[model samples]
Target: MTSDAQVLAAIINALGAPKKIPSHPPKYRRAAVAIIIRIRPDHGRSSAHSSKRRHRQQPQPQAQPRQQTSLSKQPPHAEQPSCLDEIVHPESLDEFFAQTWVQSGVFEILFIERANKRAGDHRWTGHVALPGGKQASPDEDDQETAARETAEEIGLDLADPALFRCVGQLDDRELWTSFGRDFLMVLAPFVYLQLTPKSPPLKPQPDQVASVHWQPLSLFLDRLAHPQWTPMVINLSNKLAPRISRTILRPLFGTMALHSIEMPYKPEFILRYQQELVKDTDMHEKAHPCSFSHSHPPYPPAKTRTVAMIDHYPDWDPGHRPLRLWGLTLQMVADLLELKDGPIQPDIRHKVWDSHRMRKRLDAGHLPGFSQADMHFWVRALLKFHSWQQTEKNKPSESNRVGSWESYYRMVKQAFVFVVLGRATAIAVLVRMLRAPMFRMIQSSVPSVRHSKLLK
Candidate 1:
């Protein structure tokens, strides 16, 4: 054992060693932001292939874009604010991406932040952004402030900004200013998780989010509510059964005094909101007897029901896109066959892939004309080809989605896995073909797992 003096010297040296300064410094002021919609698994997760993410694949989540279908009827107070109260006016605020990382079908997107230093225009700034910073609470009426705060933070969903409803509100505390004027600031937070408009992902506010997602409530809520169920945090009650413990906490009551008080929504909010939409207080919404069809709306058809919904997003045209087909494709095909003997497809060809018709055939309990064993063989062959391509000298490796289904599906939900990984990867312009199938897969599961089937 070292002597006390020696130990003390070591400790001093450790402390004295030039502290590992942050690669970037805080060059800007702290602004008010509400981390709404924690995860957008729908668009998948992506990490820049260049440089990003601190904890390798940190949740690359974003608020989903609004639907364009019903924007003309947007409410007057729903529009986000435009005045440049804090930072300079935003030039562009779309969700953009660099390269994608697909690990076992999980895509990770990296965000952009002001690179700790204020004087540079480095695009590779930092991640977690707070683009929305403003007085969310107005005088007696709070719609303008709410709309503005959301606009500032999440401008991606706002070409027709008035569509965003001022549904929920959270009030922050007051902070004293240097001039002795008490700054009555209430962190105004709003959500667009279920916004209608979607496409080309609005725009990229390199300062807001690197990428935006169209996360479903079921998937999104699953993540926020089931955060590994930490022991220190509140234990979920058994009443909500599985989710009885974690439904969407809303109104959080905490001290109002602060530098910019951050608030939490009680879980009941998510559950209750879901109920209100279904129960429909009158002009609230239409009424339905709560059928599985409502819960999972996009079911192929009654005659075309299948044991599983295979997303064929990236597989637009198998013959033409086969060049980019990765090994995981083969593995999933094999699993379905193994589960249902003979082969999931006795009518469809192993090489030909089209999800729409495939969905129909699978539902009818009949393969279109594809050989199950042959499909497995093709899958194995594809996996080997991908392996060779990855190991080849100069070719860019497929450093994404694990090459096998064993990892892609994980344990939770296999069919649902690729939907996310595929979409996220698609955003980064990697494995382009997978995007459509992934989306189709998500649509398939929507009715089955969704808490609400209001999808357009």
Candidate 2:
């Protein structure tokens, strides 16, 4: 079996993020350290990579492997999977939340999640039991610091430094420092190896790890995604009702166009969460040219892209305005992020997209468009959108809460906070100014009575 450590070292080299090099003759950035415990299940004698076994308890004939048959080739012993055999999941780890999760210069994509948890009080909880880095004396390199810290934290041998991984680094940032300026520090990416029965000799040291043990990454993810998780998802369809209704949707009234779409659900869509938002056959049955049908998006053995959001909205055509926005957003975001060239520049916002020297990368295939560095920047902008404090205040709705009967008979909700915080002045004025609603309303009515929806 190939040493996981060696695999990790190769990965670090390919990532090329300077912070990961611990023996830094000239250190580039701050980083955190972690340990990737390889917990091999009892039946499967631990080996990180998959390779054929020459011998096993079950009777089998061993044939020399000239080359394993793949789609492009056929070998003498190529056989279909047995129908009676139980399906075993292939091992793998998923990229974290960042768009370039796998590609994050600061991150080291490591082990797969544990297949199943064992019953116990659960000190391991769900963590894979990674560790953090602490600087040793200035004399020590970051890699040295990592080895020292890991040994101190988990009682492992640093002399065999090759057991640890040196994944790249990410620039860490924190807000509201005691002195007022941002408090910035990086958590280096180095992982420790947890040997069996001993569990890496975790005898906690003071000023080292506050606590230690293994836990699945999923457990932490569960806590973060829980509704009670702090900074809960603030539902805005109500809070920003006035701004959404008055400003954004106002100008869009007449211009809002719809054509039932039928697009392919490629593997990328599956990775992005579109697989779960499966439309009913009826919807797919009637999909227009632009929309995806149910099946051409053959699920690939490996996945690449993912869907961002799938939610409903009221302001635009109730059929699915948000999907339309998401569709359009995906189209432009890839271009705007410069992952793809938008020279022909499809869609309305083409003029708004700024092209820089970075555009040259489009010609080069460091990626089809943006480099991994570009992806990090894109992620940063999204974070800004989440943390931005500006308001989107707006005009009041003329309709009085959908009438007493509907309010009494059905659930009614509105986003007062979002509306108050969005922008100044309700969006109704803009709608009135643009005369958009009236124009759209008139499309279904005689042109002479175009402004009639406003009367209602």
Model 1, backbone clash pairs (residues 3+ apart or across chains), number: 55
For candidate 2, the lDDT comes to 0.30
Stretch of 10 with least lDDT, candidate 1: 253-262
Instruction: Give the alpha carbon lDDT tens digit for every residue of 305-385 in model 2.
Output: 433331222122234211111211111111212211222212221111121221232111111111223223443343333
TM-score of each: 0.22, 0.29
Could you say which candidate leads in lDDT? 2
Q: Which 10-residue span in candidate 2 carries the lowest summed lDDT?
A: 263-272
Output the lDDT of residue 284, model 2: 41
Clashes of each: 55, 49
